[model samples]
Target: MTAEQKGARLANLWDKTLAAGMSEPERLIYRSNLLGSDKRITNYGGGNTSAKVMEKDPLSGQAVEVMWVKGSGGDVGTIKRDGFATLYMGKLNALKSIYRGVEFEDEMVDYLPHCTFNLNPRAASIDTPLHAYVPKKHVDHMHPDAIIAIAASKNSKELTQEIFGGEIGWLPWKRPGYELGLWLEKFCLENPGARGVVLESHGLFTWGDTAEESYLTTIEIINAAIGWFEKKITGPVFGGDKYRPLPADERRKVAGALMPVIRGMISAAEAKVGHFDDSDAVLEFVSSNTLEPLAALGTSCPDHFLRTKIRPLVVDFDPTNPDVAGTIAGLDKAVADYREGYKAYYERCRHDISPAMRDPNAVVYLVPGVGMITFAKDKATARISGEFYVNAINVMRGSSSVSTYMGLPEQEAFDIEYWLLEEAKLQRMPKPKSLAGKVALITGGAGGIGRATAERFLREGACVVLADIDAGALEAASADFSKRYGSDQVRSALINVTSEEAVADGFANSATEFGGLDILVSNAGLASSASITETTLALWDKNIDILAKGYFLVSREAFRIFETQKIGGNIVFVASKNGLAASPNAAAYCTGKAAEIHLARCLALEGAEKGIRVNTVNPDAVLRGSKIWTGEWKEQRAAAYKMSTDDLEEHYRSRSMLKLSVFPEDIAEGIYFFASEQSAKSTGNILNVDAGNAQAFTR
Candidate 1:
């Protein structure tokens, strides 16, 4: 097909060259990855695919039919060979004898371990039976938007027939389990010629004799649905526009202004990361007259609402008037109402066996004329939740245009949301780290001390924004962090801390990126070793400008954000031991450091009522990886001590009472202690990380 033709349809990415040298299981992985590479076919971790392969049993040493399927909690797009669980087909089939009806179907999950082939440790997902019972050699199950659009319509069954005719069948909504497996098997038996079936309000399943055939069939079926929708949608979707979106820049400003407050309000229980989406679909939906009604009805696909929740809370705002302040003022009541309603929903739908009520905060929030906001425990999840909602928007657009859209039934949704098995999965998850869900911004982030601190925070589960005056270094550092941790857990901002406008803009960017700040590490600094007599006015201004004024500017911006959030914040100052103890010949440096230390004390005194904490970590010397040890400062300090630059580290180490060298990681540890809950109640305190420097003691 031509490129234009492919653009209008799902591209068949199957390559015979790529598939020629692969094992059956390997081909399944390849096909699954191809199918999942596009969000149009499947959302992140939302779909499963399988193939039946004959492999020698580890114990019996005999070839047996083994079902290889995407393991539980695995995403098909990134699935490796090990991601597929291997189950013996004979054992899976034998499970039908003990099938005690739909009510007891959940118990069927327990027996899956017995069906494990070759003692594969990967757990079989609940969808295993759905794939296992299908007699086809390969099956592809997906939550494609175009397919689900038909599946979620009020006339879904008829629409399915209209779209695919006899090529694909339709099955009414049945909670996926062993029972649903039987339904699929029955459908396949009844319509042996049919290639696929669309599960009502769930997704699509297609099968073929080979992995490539199944993958191609899945995409082709979705492409057909896409073509049908394109031809059928006659007018504007969502009843046309009610309000045009704010200008892009204005929208960002609004998001930057609003997210922190919302994040702070909802983050009382646990810290959250925020994701903002103003995509074309989101804008179209939010600006529509039907936005409120459509959003209230909730998303149709189960995968969509699993992350987005059943429905979104539409923010009260009129784009025509653009009253951001007014909106902020009214947000408290709106948020409170949303929580109460969510609680009532939990109370109304929860079964006695249901897990306890979870956080009542809405995951997805819609702003008319701006876009969508989603908050979650981490940035990736929040971002994915927004993406899922966008898929739901597309689903609603298609379903509503061709026919009436229908959300999943309340009881069915509740059952799935609070399913005991789902609860067990939640319980089985590892405990969150101490800094989990926290957002931090570190100035001088490209420098050794700053990068070390950020690495520590990222390791402990905090999302970090790396801000620096050096653009190249910032980019390099950001890239390194993204490689080590993940892009979702870190962002970078080019910031001249001494510039008020730059600092303000950087903080705003940080707020918009991660949904507000929780920890601010004011580590940006430089050093000079000039005597009081030799320190020129230019040198004095330079030191004071960056060290003193820069700190003030960043702190003011952080404080402004902290006030907006109403959540307690943390500020860790990477000051110098010279701040407390006199340093010979380093008059300007000592004064600047002294200013940073005093500023922390004053900020602590002023912010204690609001739960903000300010603390200082004083280091005598951190030469390794320290940017301050470069250029003239190192030579100046060395010459002042009557030594060469190479001997400065040794001289400082020997001069310390503990006779130990201090590295950037040591300063990072001190900063971590103050920034974390380890010092939750202590503020205006100084930590001496100078290897037993008696002169810099807090006393």
Candidate 2:
């Protein structure tokens, strides 16, 4: 295909969106998704797009020109019509009248919300006014890495003019807001023929009469910038023959050893909030010979300071033969020195006599050649910040080949870091989910109850590691989870909880994957129905190994990790109602479950001093979607009830006072209460999720 044809093909890719008959807002969604789909353009929630469209106001039944800009907090890649906030164009323009006389920068935020034409409470992105200021029908804004690489450099203005000539308007670094919007508007009107505008230390903006034209323009400019950089810049910045990367296993070992220490140091000790997720690429980059000088240069741009802070904290360590214990020993002093250095930097650059400092802890931790660990309020944020730094490294590499990498000066970084408008933009983020920063380990995770609980914890924002004995079932369940809740949020381990080695390896994997554990759901089990007279030795042993011994093994390992991390956690056992009230032909099953409940109580007592909570969920006959409720055992239970399998299911439902069927989801809900802070003080408690089973109710 020719160049034009290829460009058309790429633009058409975004056309597969919404329904056939698309509204203007839906088209905006399609375009935003197109922009977001390319990582080179923007990371999740990093860019904004807008379109000026005429829509009928529901209340007035009159045509209104509303500027639908990308709303705050939604990933541009998955944005829908609702992702764009609709604002009255006339009202937004009216703000210009008072812009000239404005005294404070924060006053823009106070009045910006009032410009909304739609009654929806969604806040517009900080760049909404910038998009609104443009007179074009469609405007595209994005933080393309290639574009930012040049824009954030020391000679950004000189480079821009050399590359794009007078076709692109250049603006000095200005904190984004109402004043910036006014400045951009005046610049655009004066340079009407300019294809786009480059916002130094920020991002790029392009516009056209149609979405295709605007999107294509953005692609063209970014491609041009990337092409120019490739010609001007040369070779790898970090990797060399002298600096060897650690073997995969060694890297993982180092990461596992040092993550907890880094997590503890950077974390808010009182709140117990932090994420120590690692990246192999990041580790390699940090460990390379070129890291020392490159890291000190600061972020690629001012916009990133919110995520990456001013610069990374480089902790000294010997990567060749890592001293895991020694590294751990030095973390306190290393972090202390880092905080002192940061305070000194702040004091030297403060605009006021007593400026309020942001978090003194480092967001990105570079442990020389060993590895790199990033900490944030949660997994997602830490991952995003890591991404920004990786991009920054790339930008620095390119800029280094050409000349020295000069990022936003320290004063500029501090201004953006503590800017009230920027702070307010973050404050507008939606409230976090219940288990936002917690990590959960769910055993028997591919099974009915296990899968349900894994999903439940994920929905509440916890990073979940699903452990299952069946590798196939675990793989399938993991793929399903990765699709629904993102791969970062869920992981799987092939573990037989009955095996001491398997249990140990599984918890170790969990700690390595997510730094540490917060909640342990011991739900992996099997149901056995055999009378004492007819019970087989094999069946009794298998049941005891899984239900009784398995819970003990997993709980024991969890307790060890909890004590080591010093973050008191929770353990929830999936005991059955049979343990509470004995039933016929279930002697082995009842004995095993009874042992589990007693074990939980024992641990609850011992763990009390450490603030560890242990609780049990006694679910009775959870037939729906239960693996144990199928095959020969299910048939035997049906036979014992003297009814068909369907009838047996109904019988169990009718046995409950509420006449509701028990399900894995119901059991999961009970586990959630104990796992979360909802039951902060309720340890050793039995939550019966049998739909009001009086016999199973805790006395």
Candidate 3:
């Protein structure tokens, strides 16, 4: 087919995608075809697409529905309905109302629990609210090759002005998802009739009342930019016309040396599912240019920075030099310099946030004589690196003729790739604890503390079973966690901690789901407050029956079955509180907390014989926004503490030596330490995260 015919066919497919009143699965299939049809539109999983579906609300007798957004790490070209996280629209809208006029990211994390979608296999898109805010039936966002070429141009604004005229709106590059979504939200509210949005230093977002308009707008915008570049510039003619393929023996050697590093970055499962593309596109780009000029070009877009660092390693080896040691040392120095630069960038952006993993040689770009090889732990990551370098080369070539290309500034690029919003996207998914290949059961997994602990364990790389009595909350939390983490990493079971049979069944379910349990977080509990005189038997019985008895039952099962049977060392953490030792107005709560602490101590002593380490985290007020501190609870706590709601929060923070509020994340860190190798020699400990709230002399 002719080029124009191919473009038209892709456009027609997009039209069909929007026009057809198909089910969610069918729409995903069509969307994938349209995006895949044009190499310029999307490569592999570079973009995201979503559709809103109507379903009955189990809570209210209403026909409320959700938008099934594409999950993380899933390719848009092949994503299915199961891959789309079902974010309840009503819940999202409600959250927006509660946190009215606040930033969308804050709203998302706060209201994440209300959404009824499972968290595994699917996750709400990082751009979930952006798609939701468009007021369109369907939304399409992509990193189109043609658009990136134009955006990466020296005269990008001028080029866009000439091609799109006044139809396109340009947004200065901000971190995507939350900040970008907010900016787009305001821009859309103002313009109301914009054709599409061109995110400078990022990508394009196009939408319409119908999916076809959104898709066509994306196509037209890209075509216009491509046409302008073609008209304005001419391609360079190379003198070397002879095409020579590398020798078969040498090619095999090159591939063999690189395969191990590549395989480590991604999964064997993903490698089998998708075709690896370490082809001429990547090799040609690496060998075409001088190392220095190529490094100066930056990434294709800021998003690509996560997969492929800002640039690659310039492998200039002199095999004939005879001093092999000197050559290897020189290469090592180059890599060390790259790592130093990365560290400087991190330090500059640091604000009490923990540091991310640093990969010194994300990509290795060899010279003309030497073959190129990209390094990633897996094929998926390696392919991402390969694709990014290929795109960057194209941009560099296109811009060199016209003018120097300026990419995202260092800070802006850092923010895009490492922003909390993006990190939250990865965290939303469930995984095994740091104790990978081990089994864990998190009680009260539906609650704030329990959920935080569960997410932390999953990230550390362990399979988790989240058990809770609140079935609705459990389902919603599980759905949200699974979307980013994957369904296999976590499972949800409904169990009332007060019932022995239910607790037993929950453990059985966990063992069946994850092979066997090795860690137990006895996190299930209540938090009702009442004066000693006001506290009744009912409240006392309720708190003790669950918090105290629940801890004993869960720990007992782990010691007998999981730890002893596997003959592996195990860990048990009780989510006790600072209030357990300190005085509190809530009589029942204080009694339960104190008993829970004693139970942890007893269990720790008993489990020592079975090679299980039991511990507890005495957390101070974890005041981050969530349902626990919503509305009256927040206001009342603030009032009783003799400060404005906001100021009252500062008091809790001031009590800590770090002057930072004790976040659920801080408690999770403590949990991780106990479960990690660093704490292997230690056991029967109580980690206090109250920020020095309890002085020894005070009691």
Question: Best by lDDT, which number?
Answer: 1
Where does candidate 3 stray beyond 4 Å?
A: 1-11, 14-21, 36-39, 59-61, 98-107, 117-121, 237-280, 288-291, 317-329, 369-371, 400-403, 421-699
TM-score of 3: 0.53
Ten contiguous residues with the weakest lDDT in model 2? 1-10
How close is each model in CA RMSD to the real structure? Answer: 1.8, 4.6, 20.3
Residues 414-524 of candidate 1: C-alpha lDDT, one tens digit per residue: 888898988898899999998999999999999999999999999999999999988888999999999989899999999998899999999998888899999999999
**Clash list (residue pairs), candidate 2:** none
lDDT comparing candidate 2 with the true structure:
0.79
Candidate 3 weakest ten by summed lDDT: 266-275
CA-lDDT, candidates in order: 0.90, 0.79, 0.62
CA deviation > 4 Å runs, candidate 2: 1-27, 53-66, 88-91, 101-103, 118-122, 239-242, 264-284, 339-359, 475-488, 531-534, 580-587, 637-662, 685-699
Candidate 1: lDDT over CA atoms?
0.90
lDDT-best of 2 and 3? 2
Whichever of 1 and 3 has more lDDT, that candidate is 1
Candidate 1 residue 652 C-alpha distance from true site, Å = 0.8
lDDT per residue (tens digit) for residues 625-648 in model 2: 888887777988887778998798
